[model samples]
Target: IISPDSVRLENGTSLCSGRLEVKSNQSTQTWSSVCQQDFDQQDAEVVCRELGCGAPSVLQGVLYGDVEPPMRTTEFQCGGHESALLDCRSSGSDRTTCSPGKPVGLTCSEPVRLVGGASRCAGTLEVKHNGEWRPVVYSDWTLKTSAAACRELDCGSAVSVGEREESSYRSVWRIRSDCVESGSALRECAAPDFSFSSSSSFLNLTCSGKPSPCWDNLQL
Candidate 1:
């Protein structure tokens, strides 16, 4: 059995024996014993919280042990019109702690200039998790993600990606990416996953000139 935070076994015992790995806060484990004792599957669990040892003394004289879960990172994708999500506060250090139920939400609704345009048009992309909107970080914005955005917005060819800082931003999620292009239908480009750190703050992208603009922008 799997719990949201930790694992447990029968005989009313708290087992801390081996290593386990979970992704997106979801994981599974298999149990098989060579002993002659009958094992109860109902008492075994991959629990999320620490079980009280002094509650009722479940393990009086039984062979039981537990192992810590392995650390994992979940990768998320960004679309052409959407900026990728980021954990701004770095609040949740563990993947299991940052469960999929608590995923990051990002949105981009500000009008931006494509390539070199006189008027700035904009669209917004929002991530829904735990019922809130968190803006995407622009620090690690990639051309692929930006290109996808341009294509999604029918904003012509992607020429560059830029980041801007705003003081009054609601969520401290004010990373802005600028795309430059022409036309009405934005072309689709493969979005890539980017890491967050001090060194990778600026991103630039150049699109392929396919004369007819064959990229699929309708599917989003």
Candidate 2:
């Protein structure tokens, strides 16, 4: 999911978690890592937002394999709300050296939400896109599938994963267990189809306590 944003994460288990890489504005087009010292929470926020993900959960250096530079010499100064990382201000001068293996490795949380419930952990599941939160309809989903959502929400183990019958049909996102099992963020998982239907059910979860590693180890 390399976007036109000229910033990307590499050497990660998935697109949502990886080593930070930025494309050079040079005519020939090169990609380089950013010094961890040069990037911050504000920069991390913009990177996550630009990539259509939740907030930055982890930022560590050398978590991704140590790669040497051809790195960006300038420091990024993001205001914390830019649409793209490149949209931020850069230092006028070049940094001569960065410590070895000090480039950033970042992990962004999944863009999943729970609404209309008693707590942040319990509610109808929704995935975000463009700006609006879209409810999802998942016929093939299970507790295994909801487990990932719990992890994303920082909720405990998925106590119950079920559906509630709604009175009317409306447009909602469609999610599949296979795609979610592949472990992509709900929005990043392929196109979670959006359409109006009489499915009459919206996916729901009641998450409580702490999450279980068992959910992570289950087979689909």
Candidate 3:
């Protein structure tokens, strides 16, 4: 008899829930007998122990009553231009990487990409460093820059720019902007073409542009 939480793949193989442990092939079992089994919490632990699968640390606190499993930060890499986010770390190591197509290591308190610019495997990104949310300044900000920001922010596309809120008379090159994130900062989007303003120590950014994709040299 198997637990209800068990997963039965299309191949007729069943993987019990507790530890994602593989069980005897479903085809080897009689349907009549298998259907009669029941599943419960105790069975969960048994399944995991049998399969040699360790409990997932992320769920240990909520599921197994282990209140302080461990603290960790995740990371991601996208757009193919720059580096990875801040939190992506290895299971047992303090080191982390955001290689091509991976995510960077950004903390929860830090803003990450939400909607657009995750093309080319890596690109520019933003994070709340110090006390202000600032854009990662590359050698220069271009159309690709805006697109990456918009996609990461999940704000559809870049629109326009005017003047900084701190100084409406300042030049566009002198202002920074704020980006609202959707999920990951690796989606595709355009750069901001407008001006942004800020009263606090935050940088001013209000750029608007098209929603076209950046040129991926490898794809074309």
Using lDDT as the measure, the top candidate is: 2
Worst 10 residues of 1 by lDDT: 38-47
Query: Across residues 1-220, which tens digit of lDDT does each residue of candidate 3 receive?
Result: 1223322211111121211212223566421111101222233233232322222111111121111212222211222221111112223332222122111111111133222224421232434322233343222344444554555444455543112223232222221322222222221111322354433121223334235333222110
Number of backbone-clashing residue pairs for each candidate, in the order shown: 26, 1, 70
Local lDDT at 142 for model 2? 82
Q: Each candidate's lDDT (Cα)?
A: 0.28, 0.76, 0.26
Give the clashing residue pairs of candidate 2, or none.
157-211
| TM-score to true structure, per model | 0.23, 0.81, 0.23
* Candidate 2 residue lDDT tens string, 61-135: 888788876465579999998999988998867676788888988887767788889887888888876666778
Evaluate model 2: give its lDDT. Answer: 0.76
lDDT of 1: 0.28
How high is the lDDT of residue 64 in model 2? 79
Q: Which wins on TM-score, candidate 2 or candidate 3? A: 2
